[model samples]
Target: LQEYGLVSYHSLNLLKTQALALGLPPADLRSIKARYSFAWNDQGIKYLGITLPGKFEDIVSTNHKKVFAETKSLLLRWRLVRLSWLGRAAAVKMTILPKLLYVFRMLPVPVPKPLLNVVHRDISSYIWNGKRPRIPFKVLSAPLEDEGLKFPQILAYHKAAAIASLSESLLIHQPLWTYIQSIALPGHSFPGLLFTPSKSRPPLPTALQITRWSQNVMTNTYSPGPMPHNTVGGS
Candidate 1:
């Protein structure tokens, strides 16, 4: 078949020989290749905006820095314009929050506490025009009906996004990602495995770590008592 393919093999020489036998030109084959190496300095190549085979923490940290930088630039520019408190809040919701929410949804990882604090501080400064705040952040985060500004709570929103991702994986039957994630979770049903305690569960792959962490967080937050183990059998 004359189709694009990805080959993973132990021996590069063996792979090259097979490719030649299959009529794949050396130049065409060499043009696209990624080999894991202990001495490699570069991060994995980007495919569809994700850094393949890179550490999940590194990806999250990179995106976090980007989002913070972009938001800070926007806030500085907006400060030049005269806007009411309400208008500032609207600007943040429309522009800044969407960028953050996108990252939260895409990665679904537990954001570092220090990173979250930094974002919260910068966003607070922007909202208050770098002056002492007249209203508390918690009140600002409340809905309009409750006499508040409906400000985005970064930590809450991040947790919600992680929970949403977990829900999507659980509710969707045999999702493509589940198959890949399941490779690390042999013989365990995804739904039941979610209920298994962190100590009892095996070390999860990077992609599923946030989902598992979010599950535990939700259980702790909402459950009246300790959650029972409910691990189901079969892969």
Candidate 2:
């Protein structure tokens, strides 16, 4: 076992025997002896579980059950987090290559500089440039699935699907949708003012349309004239 680097009782015995046979110096022997003592270190707490003269069981009272419970709870929590990460990473690895192909397909065939810039900027701003890196799949789904809070690192497969679908098919209506927002305004206007984009626009408004009009232009107006004056019994 020692020859193959397996840690086992047989390997330890073989190494010890060979060291003794070589007539290793006293200092080396002491180092070798130290290594044989089985110990466990947690944070800074060291326990010579087997080799020390007294074990923790002998010094610490076993009746303090709460400490053991806390330790177990902490250990279980750590394991749960570790296992969750492992599972998520494994799933990501399996889907990443295929999903990336879809995202690339979503990319415009003859990508324009400005449009690419917009896509890159939106993807970077909403998806990439944050502390958490978005998984490609997750980036696709986020706006659709309505996942409010997002972590940069982990993205789900369904989300990538959403992004892919949006890229391939959903974005087709973007131009028409935007055209509608630009031409229409919402609700009845006040006596002096024009329409605001809410009531008249589509079910939604584009960021651009809102940006084109100033807030003052969108404000509601009261009646332009005051009540008619009474001209001393009738004019």
Candidate 3:
């Protein structure tokens, strides 16, 4: 158009002339299709107020919908199954665990205990027919040789996933991790090594912001007792 703020798009000969006619800055008239190369991007992929393809350190998910919805759908449908105890265990192993892992692939944080407990309640109902199990849950969690179903523990799994995600940035020395460390933990190093900044040296605002944001994400993901809070409002 003749006058517009900024609309990023692929380059063509006419568009360049139009941009010049509009008196837009030369720097503003350009394309990134080749640079980005992101397919199936109709909306250009936005996250955390920044446009994609953003930094690895900026990718933080605050809530989960896909995982919760899939798990809930499976749990609800599982009610109609008329099966024995061990048979029910097989059903869970086949139907539920796979869905859980599917969601866990995208979910980088540990799900809250209260939310996970509700799912576990649905799982408990499916397994024991809404009756208190003869064996304790801790015992029920044991391996087959120890005479247990080796049931999936949601909280444990979530925490493990979170730890694994943290390790991506903290332990593994990938290119993304290296870039993140330079910004996030500039002074700090592994094995408890950190150099103090001098009067001339100072922490960067942008780096500190990203670092704190990442830390907050990990902080929010904590494992707790298997009890859904009473104030959990859902019908």
TM-score winner among the candidates? Answer: 1
The sequence of per-residue lDDT tens digits that candidate 3 reaches over residues 1-235 is 2223335453434333311112235454335433333343422354433333223332332235445666677767766878887687678778887666645544444355677887777777778866777667788788889987688887777655644544454454554644655655466552121111122234445534533333434344543335563211111
Worst 10 residues of 3 by lDDT: 190-199
How many clashing residue pairs appear in each of the predictions shown?
0, 9, 0
Q: Which stretches in model 2 have alpha-carbon errors above 4 Å?
A: 1-84, 90-174, 186-235
Q: Report the Cα lDDT for residue 46, model 1.
A: 46
Order of the predicted models by lDDT, top scorer first: 1, 3, 2
Q: Can you give the TM-score per candidate against the true fold?
A: 0.70, 0.15, 0.53
List model 1 lDDT by residue over 1-235, tens digit each: 1122334433333232311112337675455334321233235444345443345557765776777778888898999989887788888889899888887877777677888888888888887899999999989988989998778998888878876766655775656776776676788776666555555666666556765677765555443334344432111
Better of 1 and 2 by TM-score: 1
Candidate 3: misplaced stretches above 4 Å? 1-63, 169-175, 190-235
**Winner on lDDT (1 vs 3):** 1
Flag the better candidate by TM-score, 1 or 3. Answer: 1
Q: Which pairs clash (backbone N, Cα, C closer than 3 Å) in model 3?
A: none
lDDT of each: 0.68, 0.33, 0.52
